[model samples]
Target: MPLPHLLRRRAPRSGARRTARRLAVTVPLVSLAGVLALTGCANRERDAAPGAGTSTTASSAAQTAAFPVQVTVPGTDHAVTVERRPERIVSLAPSSTESLFAIGAGEQVVAVDNQSNYPEQAPRTDLSGYTPNIEAITGYNPDLVIASNDTEQLVASLEKVKVPVLLLPSPHNLDELYAEVTALGKATGHLTEAEDLVRTMRSDIDKIVKDTPKPAKQLTYYHELDPQLYSATSRTFIGQIYGLFGLVNVADAAGGTGDYPQLSPEHVINANPDLVFLADTKCCGQDAAAVAARPGWQSVTAVRDNGVVALNDDIASRWGPRVVDLVRTVSDAVTRTAQQG
Candidate 1:
C-alpha cells in the first residue's frame, strides 16, 4: 500500500526547531511527516455566501492594499514579501491548493501539483511536490508559488528563477492554522474572503465543541494512522483534535519517540480503548470489520461494541477547512458512544 504522505518521515530542518517554543503545548517536536500530514488536502468546497461574486472588485482592492506586505511564514525564519497581489499562482501542496480555492483565489491558480485532486476543478499538473522540478514549475510562469515543506533546494531553485515561494508548513495548533489562511488570503488578494472563511470555521468548530457534551467519564480512543498500529499522540495536531472531546489517547503511554509512533498490536490489545478511529479507510481499506478480524483485536472494547469510526483519509489527514467536517464526525461518534453507555 502506498504510504500516505502524512505518515512518511522527512528530514529534520531548522524550521522545526524554530517553532518548538511556540508549540510547547504539543508533545514531541513536529516532524516533517507530522507537518506533511497537517498540510495535505482533498475535495469538497465549503458553501459560498450568496452574492459572493458581487464583491470581487472591492475584495480585490482590499487585497491590493494589503499587498507589498511582508508576512513571516510559520515554522520558518524566512519572511516572504509579496510585492503585489499575485495574479498567477502555483500550488505545490494539496492543502495550499485547497486554501487558495476556499479563499476565492482559485481563479488565480495557474496549476496545482499532481496530488491536488480536490474541488475537482484545480488545474492539475504532473508537477511533483516531493521532487520539485524547477523547470516544469517555472514553465507556468507563476508569479507566486505556495508550498508546505521548504526544502532548501526547492526554495533556492525557485528563488533563482525569480519566482517568490511561500512556505506554509503544517500548523501546530488552530491559531497557526488561522494565521496560515490569513497569509494565503493576503498573498492572493483574497483577504476579505479568507477572513470570512476563518471566522466561519472558528465559529463552526467552537459550536461543535460547545454542543457536544463530554462523556460522563473520560473515553479512551485509539487513532489508527495505518493498519500496522502507527498512531498519533495527543501532542500531534490530529491528537489535539481528539483532545477537544476530552478523549484520552491510548498511544500517549506507548513510549513512542516521535509524533507519529508505531504501536504494537499487543500493546493496543492490552489497552483495549473504548473507541477506534481509522484514518486509513481509503488508503489501506481498513474498516471496523477488518479491524475486528485482526487476531486478539476482536476482544477490544471498541471493536466488540461497534465503536469503530471509519473516516475519510483526506479529511482526517488534512488541516484545511474540511477540519470542521472531521471534528463534527468525531463529535457525533462521541455523542453516540456517550449515550450508549
Candidate 2:
C-alpha cells in the first residue's frame, strides 16, 4: 500500500530521527541461526499444503508475561509500558490493523483508521492515520494507539494526552517484521499467538520458495508500484521477498532515493525485465493490456509473453499476515514462467 500522501511527502522531524536511532539500538538483527530455523520449519510445512496443519496454541506461561511489559516502540525513544492488556485499541495504520487482527487482538481494537478496510469487521471510521486529529482520536478514549510512522506532531499530540502509542515503521526486512509482530503481541497480551502467527508466516513463505523451480537463467523482474513508474528497490522489504526467488530487480540500477523511486518509461523499456509484477492493479487499474498499451512498452518481454502478474494493491503494499498470500501468488507466476521455458 502506498503511504498516505501526507506521510510520503512530509519531511521527518528531528524527534522522529532520534526515535529511529533509538529503534536501531534497541532492536537486534535476526541471527543466521534463526533464519535457518524458519527455513527448516517451512520445508516441513511444504510437504503438506500451506495452513493445513497449523497450530494455534497460546502458552499459559506466555500470557503471564504479557502485562506491565515495557518495549521501546520502534522509531521512538520513549519506551511504552503496557500496564495491562489494552482493551480499547486504535490502529492508525492498515498494517497495524491487520497485525492486531491476525494475532487475535481484533476484539480489543475499538476503532481503526479509514484506510484499514480489511477483515470485514474492523471498526472503520473517518479517522485519518496520515493527518491524525488529537481530538478525534481522544474521543475514543483508547488506551493504546498503534501506528506505522511517528510524525513528530502526531506522536507529541497523543503522548500529551497520556495515550501509549506504538510507532512501527515499515520494516526493512523479514527479521524486523518478526520483531514488530512480537512486540505487538507482548503489548496486547497475545505473545504466544503472535509467535505462532510469525512461525506460520515464515513456514508458508519458505514453502513457496522451496516449491518454485529455478529458472534456466536468472530472471529479471519489474515490480510496479504505480502506473507512474514508481518502484521498490532490492533493499526494501518487498524487494527482499522477490529476491528470495533469485530474480534480479530491474529498478536497482536507478539508484532511487528512499525505498521507492520513480523510473522513467524509457529506462524501464531499456531494461526489459522478464516478468512484471503490478502492485497497482487496484490502485491504478494496471494490467497486462494496460501495460502493453503504454507507449514503447509493447516490446517489453513481460508484456509480449503475457507474464505480467496483477496483484492486490493492499496485499502488495502492506506487510502483514496476508504477505504469505502475496508470496504464493508470485510463486505461481514464476512457476508458470519456468514451465513455459
Q: What Cα-based lDDT does every candidate model obtain?
A: 0.71, 0.70
| Candidate 1 vs. true structure, TM-score | 0.85
User: How many pairs collide in each candidate, listed in order?
Assistant: 0, 1
Q: Any idea how many clashes model 2 has?
A: 1
Superposing all C-alpha atoms, what RMSD in Å does each candidate have to the true structure?
6.8, 8.1
lDDT by residue for model 1 (1-341), tens: 01122422122222333223112211121211121222232111223344554456666776688768887866568678889889899998776687788877887899998767765789999987766888899999999998876654888888887888988777766777788888888777777777877887788879988999778889999987666677778877778888888999998899946666678999899998999988767657889999999999999999998999997666666566767777788888899998987
lDDT accuracy of residue 296 in candidate 2: 94
Candidate 2 C-alpha lDDT tens digits along 220-334: 9998766667676777677887888899989888874545666889889999999998765654577898999999999999999888999766667666676677677778888
* Superposed Cα deviation of residue 254, candidate 2 (Å): 1.7
What candidate 1 gets wrong by more than 4 Å, as runs, is 1-52
**Which structure among the candidates has the greatest lDDT?**
1
